[model samples]
Target chain A: MSCNLTEKVSLLVDGELSPVETRAIERHLLTCIECQQARADFLNLRQQISAYTPALNTQVQQRALASVLAKQGRAATRASAQAATPEAGRRPARIFGVPAMPFAIGMLITAAVALIVTSFVFYIVFQQAERDRQQATNTQANSSREQTATVNQPPNTNNDNSKANTFGASDEAANGKQSVDQSQQQRARGPVNSESENRQTFAANARRVRSKRPASSGTALARNAGINAPLDLHVPELLPPHEASAPRYITINATAPVAAPVRPVDAGTLAARHVEQAGLLLRAFRNARTVEQDAAADLSYEKRRARQLLYQNIVLRREAANEGNVQLASLLDSLEPILIDIANLPDQPHADDVRAIRERIGRKNLVALLEVNSTALARAYE
Target chain B: MASEDAEFTMLFQEFYPSLCRFLECLLGGRASVAQDLAQESFLQLHRTVWGTIPVGEARFWLYRVARNLALNEFRRGETRHRLFDRVVEALRPRTQTPEEEYETQERQELVLSMLKGLPEDQRTALLLREQEQLSYREIAEVLDVSESKVKTDIFRARTALRERWAQRVRAIGASVR
Candidate 1:
């Protein structure tokens, strides 16, 4: 018992012993000098410690209590002040310093709803603006193009219709310049800048037309007919003995004409070369009148070639008259004016103009003259 | 019928002076540091909301925080020792003869130096058991160890301190000869 009590003396001094153990230790201590000495030593050392361990003075203890109270008071005031103020966009309510997801979700939904409403308002406004624009377009459509042009044109121009036709030339240039081909059509439908860029642009267009157009064409008779080019008529260069090209400068007063140069046709055969040239002219006229709508531009190029042939055919037609080929001469007479009209036709000709030219050829029997005369001319080569 | 604040204030009134005295004793008589540690311990209690805590054991909680903070201060080295030394000097016994006062102070220094020299767990166990009058279970609560560990530490601290005290006295006697 003393052995057990001896080791537990610290616990005994600390009042840490169980009641049963304390009783056992205390009972043993009454008779056990060794246990008694152990108990005395533990108490004496503990008392010595207690004797020296410092205690805070009354003043220091009060100061600490006051400081704690002051801190609590300041916290209470700050929390109250925060509660009193209204928040404009306060942080969503929190629980234990974590934001409440439901409140955040509500704010997100509210923001989404507001954005959708604003977009809806903008959509309505844009749709109304579009309707107004379409209405204005219909109102303008009620007026004739002439009246609309009258309203849009500058004042004091009597020949404005003619001037718009003149401006069509420049419109072509500007149309040529627009990046999108569709933009050219839109700009053409509006008032144009008629002033600058015509001469160089027209020359450039002439060069382009020359490049793509089939080889030879007569210069168009219309002034500023940029659509036309110089003609290569392929005239046969033959004439009667007394004619200007007969290699003699003979005067009418000299009854005897100088001896005529030998006939260049190799057989003294003026009828044959005239017939061949006439056949070529007739073929040109036929090609120009070939009215395929999809190939109207090629047909237009053919017409320019025919106009050139007609200019050459005048000399050949005169030779045919000298031969007294009445059918061919009459055909040539009818074909000349038609060739000029076809040549001078707008770069994009009306279908009616082509149809009319076809009708005139049908009336004049030009196709029959070509067949008959070309057959007769081939005998010279045979 | 007490509000949370009133309950806390009641606890403070009950423990604040005792807590100051406890800190002073643990810190080797730095009265100012004792006041600070006591206040900081209560502040920690106040900062932790009342609901999550086991209010039934607020005393243990306060002492635990105060002891941890005081251990940190102790680990700060020379500063705490210097403070303790100045305090010991200030609280010098004025009524005693010069030799008697010297002997008292020398003994006090030897005991304090021994306590400080012991391992922290043993020192804390011995101090909580002896100076705070804490039970082994309560000392375990403050130090976050098992009650058995607390008992072992206290026994070890006491035995070592006693053995070293005897050794120190014998050395002093040898010197006197």
Candidate 2:
């Protein structure tokens, strides 16, 4: 084991191992002194190599930036000059050679249009400012509520307090009825629907992650990730910490839909849904194999939801933040085939397939990420 | 246009240090060359239709162009080892530093020389993988190679360095004996 696992040791250090394989390697490393020495050497080598970073001179960088800006400015000036003239040796294009009265009418119409556009823009701006003010006041409570649910939020400015009091009376009524039905179902299923269970867990975890790395990584991760946290940027920092830090577990409540407006899922929203959905799938994959082998955990809803998200992201040209997000979307895209296969399986999934799923989850370190993000969400909930 | 300028500035600030370090590794430790190439790369990006390209992909494009430029210059002067040695010597402080600092400097020089000894692709691949902490796919994107080739190149590079380190230890052991 000591001699043979040298290559595997490298893989282990690099985290190129399934949970099962990782467990095996850990157990082996406990007794293998030779392997331990190899690990030390490798670590030392890494340390020495990493120490040799080239210094960046800020003067050179500033100079470079100015050069770039000047170049861009020159190009833009050229473009603008070209745009100013329609053609050489030709008069300007016109709709017609009409009377001065018609030109006066056109001027009046243009003035009216401008006035209307200005008014409309002012109204939108006012609404946005008003919403921002309201959000600032409710930041505390809404942040706490974030633990129990993540919504298909309509722009952060869509503070539903006014909506709950005003429009969409029928929509609220329908949602209330659905909530009742879900509550009734939960009663039958026992305490599995404990609303604050996940909230309390994630909230605590968020605090822990916040405490662990207070400076660079901690703040960027959205430790107390608000309900309206945007995945618009493919910030690896915004994702769960990818460092090989030990992840702590906390309970997160299932996202219970409340009386909120149901915005239709666009491509961006669908990708956001998958990122959310990936967390739950990772958590489920971690625990499912151990629990009485009840393969049909009724993930049919999530399966369908994830499948819909997949279709929307792919078919609708869902612009991810970047190629990093494209990779994530592709991972989610690959999950559709797996979900379809999982749906077709019998009540109790075959052990082999379950192992395959777990392996996929472990290889991606999805469990750790799920823990990291859930912890962050819990902190946000607080 | 102001927003675009700010965007370019932000990208420059974020990537400048890492790009310079990566270039230094590729161009055999010439810090000035690394700085120039990195600036030129960013300058090229600034001149491009950056809105059409993804930021991550744009970063890889910078690395790719810098790599090509370095390789071209290397071809012009077939003395990569001499270049590496010159930079290492120049970078070494004349006055004595702490024992730890000296050891670190020596280790860094050894690493650069070991890096110099490897094939160009293997060296580039290894540095991208370990130094920049880029994923194999990312290294592949930057180097314009297949993912499998990136993996093989990294593996070969690591093995060579490991063997060299082992050889050094064995030499020290024999001398002591």
Candidate 3:
């Protein structure tokens, strides 16, 4: 039977034993023949196992190493190629860490939204413009009808009746009628007064007539005419030169020059006139500092004129807004407050108040805007 | 990454032939299968755990993976039959040879037969210890067993191989007579 320490001899062959254990196994091997034989047998077994497969030749070792390295190179190349595929392949580019497709989609959506909003705003603006245009056309048509009615009216003989009947016509037509009636009454008196005296009397009567008329009478008359009937005969002198020769009580055809009244002022023409007048007032007010000596007299006239223009401004502004003339409406809207300030100024305004008004006009650049809009409106009407 | 690859290449060149030899002996002297398994083990190491594993542990890791692969080959049963057929073929005599070459071939045949007779674990332990020269601890690590088990397996394998070799020699002596 083999010695029990033969297992220790196997460990000993592998040098797995401690030095003390090695010395002990060596001593035992010197004394025991069976352990010595087992040790030799174990050594022989290790030698046989080592020799069982011959060591590969250098050529074979090199070939094996080359094969492995070559495979590793190929595997590495494949891995790198895979890593590079995202940039080189079908993967989308990124912008600011966001994918290009989604970013482009976002941009397109934003553009679509902007387009919709812009189109909606334009629609609203155009709708307003159309409404204003229609209103202005209606105003022109009504004015044309009143002028046509006046042109068609028979000349009245009674002076008082003619005065009362012509009340509903435009202020220009009423003034023209009163002057013509007074001359006819003078003629009915059989030219008793001397011509120069009559001329002085007529001049005094014309001045008295103008002074008696309220500043808003023209606007009131127009408004009344829009609401009332045709009242009296039109003055021959008030008609255009071509229509002046036309017989009275003639049929007013569609092609008749009815719209060419004593003064052809539609809402657009009126707005342009208002803008021009307000620009002149603002310019005078803005430069009032240069003529401080005549400031009181000028302030009275300017304030009175501002009050009159303020009334016209409100009416024209409403008409402009109704016509969807946003540019004109907005200009008048801004001008209203300035006109109010000027109209409300004291007859003898303080220099500081005048300076403040001047500063406001300059700051708003109202003069330049008024000039530009005035030219645009005049061109539009012309 | 380049340095890691260089290190892996160095480790491969150092361990490939030894791994092939260990596998050849473990698989009962199937040289081609051993070589293939060795290459496959290295490939697996590079693919799965090259940089992740600690340095100097590749040798143990490779043997463990190769041992598992060889075990799978054994479980196939067809490989076992083929291995048996190969061992038998090594035993069959061919043309005349010099006495030294004949004896060397005879000894190799004897060793292969003795190895085939041992249990799988004992055979692996003995081959690792003798052919690969792994210590008992390393054999335990490669086999994933206790160091004491590796020692016992190696000792048992040696005892069994010695007995079988004696029996084969006696039988050969009788045939020669």
Candidate 4:
């Protein structure tokens, strides 16, 4: 019981034991002298310790304690601060307080360059397409301008009318009447003049006459007669010299000339036969004269036939004359600058070349001027 | 309510100083910290006496709370030691002889030095029995050990302290010779 009482001494001082337990330890302590002495010793020691262990107000001592406390708590303080996160996943953890700048700058520059290059390529393609479209428009405009020019051509001049007369007669001789209308239709295709059509008609007539004879005599006669006839004759002065050609030259079936020949069929008799043929043609001409005198009694019918022929010739001539004028106008339009250049100023690098250029310019200008002035002359002939 | 206030005032006046002094001793003689724990204990007691706490046992509850506070302070640091010492000095009679006071202080130093030499469990058991006056069963409850274990630990603590005190007394006698 005393052993138990000794263990209860601290509890008795603290009053931690229940009333029943306190009484038990107290009873045991009163009976046990050793336990009582042990209790007194414990009390004395505690009282003494109580004196020395208390804190007093000492500034120097408190400061020293505070320093030690701070040093001990520093690690825990820093760790707590680092662990405090308001929001997470906003930024990557910095390695050493430095950010990733190089990669981000490179990405921005690459994006900008790609945008500029794309725009530049598109600009180039669009510009090229615009230029092609402009060129096509210019070509279409030029073609329409040429068509308008053909529709607006004027009447024929004297030279054109003369050439047309030759063309119509030849057209009659070749295709007869069909070529006359066809020639007019050809005139509507472009601003061709009467002279060019006449030239073409005469050429066709000559071709027809040669083809029917199978010999060259008729061609020679027609050509020679055309030179001496009236201005209304179907003649082109620029006729081909085919009569002088080897294939077209007459082949005489004669023995020899008068001096060398001893045979009955000789060159003199052949020559006489030719003279007889000439006489026969002269008879035909006289008979036509006699018929012309007799036609004075019935003039209106004959006059009407002549006028009908003339009108047909006139129609052909007008279209043919316009065809010639169209060719000249095209040439003039191309050479317009040359003519204007010569007339406006005389400066040129080569004197002779300039003189030649001046001559051609003068001739084209003269032809254009003469044709304009000679419209009345052409009307008079018509 | 007026009567209750007067009763509360009598209880506060009676217990405040004695409870502070007892807490100082229990806290290894640190008076400033002991006073703080004592005030907290008194507040808990006040709440219970006023019917604020729902539990029936008020006195036992206050004693348990105050004892736990003093134990926790002692475990926390040596700062409580100075607080307890100062409180004990203030509580002692001023008319006591200087020699007696010195003898009492010397004995406490000797006991504390001997406690430092013992293993922690033995020192704690002896302190609870000698200073706090806890019974073997109460010491067992506080230490969370068997009552027999507390008795054995306290016996060993007393034996070691007696041997150390004898050695010190012999050394003093030899010096006198």
**Residue-level lDDT tens digits of model 4 in B1-108:** 333333343333333444554555455445567656766775545533443341213333555577777667657777535555555456544434889767766765
Worst 10 residues of 1 chain B by lDDT: B1-10
What are the per-residue Cα lDDT tens digits for candidate 3 across A246-345?
4333111112222212122355666776776677667555633324455675566567667888999998888778666687789999999999999998
- Write model 1 residue lDDT over B1-177, tens digit each, in one string: 124454465456556756765676567656667767889999778755443464436777888888888888888853644666467446432657989878876766666777776787887777767765666877888788899898888888877777777788799899999
**Any runs in candidate 1 off by more than 4 Å, and if so which?**
A1-5, A18-20, A23-34, A53-55, A80-382, B1-10, B28-31, B49-56, B75-108
- Candidate 3 ranges beyond 4 A from true positions: A54-63, A80-382, B1-6, B52-55, B79-99
**lDDT score, residue A257, model 4?**
18
Interface C-alpha root-mean-square deviation, candidates in order: 37.1, 10.9, 30.6, 51.1
lDDT of 2 by residue, A1-382 (tens): 3297776676666555679999998899899998887777767666766667564433445566777677766655554454356651254323234211232343467567867997997687666655554444334322333222211112332222111110011212333334323332332232223335523323333333223322221122211321122211111221134421322222223234232221222233444434444455445444332333344543343344345444554543334433334544455455555555544555555667666766776776755554344333333433
**Clash numbers, per candidate:** 0, 8, 1, 39
lDDT of 4 by residue, A242-340 (tens): 521212111111112122112222222322222222222222211221122333322222223223333333333343345454432343343334433
Sort every candidate by lDDT, greatest first: 3, 1, 2, 4
**Stretches of candidate 4 exceeding 4 Å from the true structure:** A1-382, B1-22, B47-63, B74-93, B115-128, B131-134, B141-145
Badly placed stretches (over 4 Å) of model 2 are: A1-4, A31-34, A74-257, A260-382, B78-103, B172-177
DockQ score of candidate 1?
0.13
TM per candidate:
0.41, 0.46, 0.42, 0.29
User: Measured against the native two-chain assembly using Cα atoms, what DockQ does each of the candidate structures obtain, in the order listed?
Assistant: 0.13, 0.16, 0.16, 0.02
